[model samples]
Target chain A: MAKSFRDSLEAGFTITAEIPPPKSVSFPKSIEVAKKVAGKVAGLNVTDNQRGMMRMSSMAFSHILLGVGCDPVWQICCRDRNRLALQSDLLGASALGIKNVCVMTGDYPTLGDNPGAKAVYDLDAVQLMKLTDGFSNGKDIRGGVMKNHPDFFVGGVVNPFYEPIELELLKLQKKVNAGAKFFQTQPFFDIESVDTFLEQAKPSGAKMLIGVTPIKSMKMLKFLNENVLTKPIPDGVSKRIEFASDQMMEGLKISAEFINGIRDRVDGAHIMPINQVASLPLLLDMVEEGNGA
Target chain B: MVYNAPAMIITKKKDFEEILFAIGDTRSLFLLGCGDCATLCKTGGEPELKEMSQKLVAKGIAVTGTAVVPAACHELDTKRVLRKHKDEVDKAQAVLALICGAGVQSVGDNTDKPAYSGCDSLFIGNSKRQLHYYEKCSACGECVLNDTAGLCPETRCPKSLLNGPCGGAVGGKCEVNSENLCVWIDIYNRLKKAGKLENLLLKISAPKDNSGLAKPQKLELKREPGR
Candidate 1:
């Protein structure tokens, strides 16, 4: 059996990386990258039509990862599916032996390539997480008895960089109440904000993996800072990246620095490579070196 | 005046075929209209009610009576109006309310006769112009206008996202509507204009407190004896 992400967290500090599925049908390139990182990290998170752009299904990609003897964190976003569809997908994931699941209120459909597509957010993240919890306990969301239950180690997303950290903390508490076993936050740049979030959220007793996105270029850093609504890249960091002769090297250094800063404070680090999927091995090496392990 | 109580907006007029089918075999009808909302919407004003009465009479049905109340949603006012027209109301088999859903309920509460809605209650909004009105508030119960720079995502955004400008927004317009500005983007720009982008950065609104909006909401204040 594949080791559970929750168990990995309990054993010690864990590392998880996200691999957004390709937009095309062919998965040779993505599968190759997953195979390389599968042994380096505890698990990999397969994004579901991330940014509303149509990609191969996260569950299908996860099944592929499982075929290759890898543990996959199958992310289920609430944006695309209604309750019935979501419940059905959960059962399908469980039947395929996909153990780890992450629940997110997905990016709006307008953000994707198909801007005209209708969104089906019949359940928000909190409600969806609650439903998954029901499935694990042998009952459907309506309290109907189930002949077989799909046990999942459910996770949720949080934004430590979000302003008004108190509200985020309250949401974290609510997610915990709704059955989120672990949390993966938006990428963090300011260490003080992470410290403050940790101080307030410590009482919730939920393990959290701080997000660390490696800046691939100056434009990428600028886009994340300006366009991304949830996480903000600080001006000081952006200025540093702008001045660097080699932005990729600067970004890797910053990613490693962020991981090192929060390694002791957080339960784990979630690395999002964005478009630079090939850099996963190098990023992992830098993280290990930063941890001095 | 301290509270900005919601004002109803005019709704779509029910199709005549549907109404005839619903009233089924009833010859006489009592028609009710709202002078406020239905009048503004051109659905249930005195003119529309008179037109409907003429249409019903033309279709071989008796128009027992018709009254345009200032606000059909006001139960006590509707009750008094119905009492004044008790003879006509008693003669009718069913009362047709040409106002919003609340008005239909109000008319039903005021009379023993079966009340049928004549127009759909669209939303709470203000008159954009003489005959134009846009939906404004969804009454989500927990208001976040302070954090959103007065533009409401709950009512404006198709998704009602708390944290947003979800990736679909293109050219400052909503992905769903395309014609309307994405409320999240509007909120961000508005905050930036006010030089208080810190509000957007600092506050993370939780999943809306849906409990505060339990249906049929009631509020009571302790009395300070007789004035």
Candidate 2:
């Protein structure tokens, strides 16, 4: 059996992958993808309506992954639920034996299908982590004691590419103080660009996992460059995929190379497949082979 | 009675068709407008009242009468204004208020007939000039203006982030609405200028206690028994 996600983090080098839950009720395909990368990664993180698009609740999907013997990182966000619902969901996740959680202030509601939906950001990311910390101490947010409280491994996100990088570093410090055990950063393709962020963050003593998403085509590269990334994709990285005969394989190679370059600098890598979950096992193999060479 | 207060209670007119649909079967209508905030917004002024009255007349609905209340949000003032036009108020089946939410409710509370709002209450704002306004406060019930160097993240930042700026800001502009500068960055600069950056860096804001946002908020000032 795979080591628990906490053990993997403490062991120094770890690998995790994020799988978005399905939009529809059925999740056989998601389970199958989780099974494929079961032993290959330290944990599988199921996203909570990533990009503001509604999907199956990450809690339900993570529970399913846990049942299949995969360590599941249940991601919870503050966009849809107020504090009451957030607290209730945390207790529910604990009752269901979902041990690891990644907290975020999810994408705004208008970015996805439901532009008319109201956003409820009652608690930001740091506050959510603080709430999770409260759970581990057997105290609810109101200071009332519960008969049995949850023991959770809490995590948060950082955006290394965000300019005024001081702002990002400050939030990183806050998250660390709020009891974030580890962090998964926003997708970064270059290692050197984030060195300043890593240097500033090292004092916090929180484990850092660099986020990587393997691009499958030119169109995706363009979309991410224009709409997603704060800093545009490095010209060299973009050109390699743009000019490649087989862009998919080239994209996989770029991700592996990027991971291999940063593995020694950071704690580990978080592979966000971006709807390409089936390619994860193969991508992991490529990274391993490159490290061996 | 002269003051330099920015402004309050900005409102915008809803589509005429929607208003028409809302007042179905009410052939006779009494139009009510506010002389202060709504008049400044141009949605409820003498011209707008006359324009609305004409539109209703063109729609084959009788215009019973119209009055611009000096302060429609004041319940007593609204009642006094309606009394001046009691004959018109009795002839009209319903009262259509072209003012802010508080003004509409005041009219509703003071009248027996159905009351409908002809405008959407936007936000408490500053009038840069006539017909040009910008939202200044969201009335979140808790103010953080001191920490932010006098800029309101609650009213300005789309995310209402308390700790700091989110990752989406680029070129000091917000990702949600690119036209607006990221208020946090502005706050940071202001704090740096004010030599209070350490306070922001050192403190982690607790989650807001939103209980104050509970609906139907009421306030009753205690007073001496015999003043």
Each model's backbone clash number: 8, 0
State the DockQ, from 0 to 1, for candidate 2.
Answer: 0.65
Highest-scoring model, lDDT: 2
Candidate 1 lDDT tens digits, A184-245: 87778878877877788898798888888889788897788666645567887888799999
User: Candidate 1 chain B: minimum summed lDDT over ten consecutive residues — where?
Assistant: B1-10
Q: Candidate 2, residues A1-293: lDDT per residue as tens digits?
A: 59988899898779999988888888787788778788888999889988889899999999989998899999999889999999999999999999999998888888878878899888888888988988988878876886689999999888887667776777788888888889998888887776866887888799998889999999999998888787788998889998999999899899988888887788988999876888888898898898422
Error of 1 at B65 (Å): 27
- Displacement of residue A93 (Cα, Å) in model 1 is 0.5
> Using alpha carbons, what is the TM-score of model 2?
0.95
| Residue A262 alpha-carbon offset, candidate 2, angstroms | 1.6
DockQ class, candidate 1: incorrect
Off by over 4 Å in 1: A229-232, A291-293, B1-157, B160-227
Candidate 2 ranges with C-alpha deviation above 4 Å: A291-293, B1-6, B223-227
lDDT of 2 by residue, B19-137 (tens): 99999889999999988888888889888999999999999999899999988888999999999999999999999999999999999999899999999998988877757789868
Taking all chains together, each candidate's TM-score versus the true structure is: 0.64, 0.95
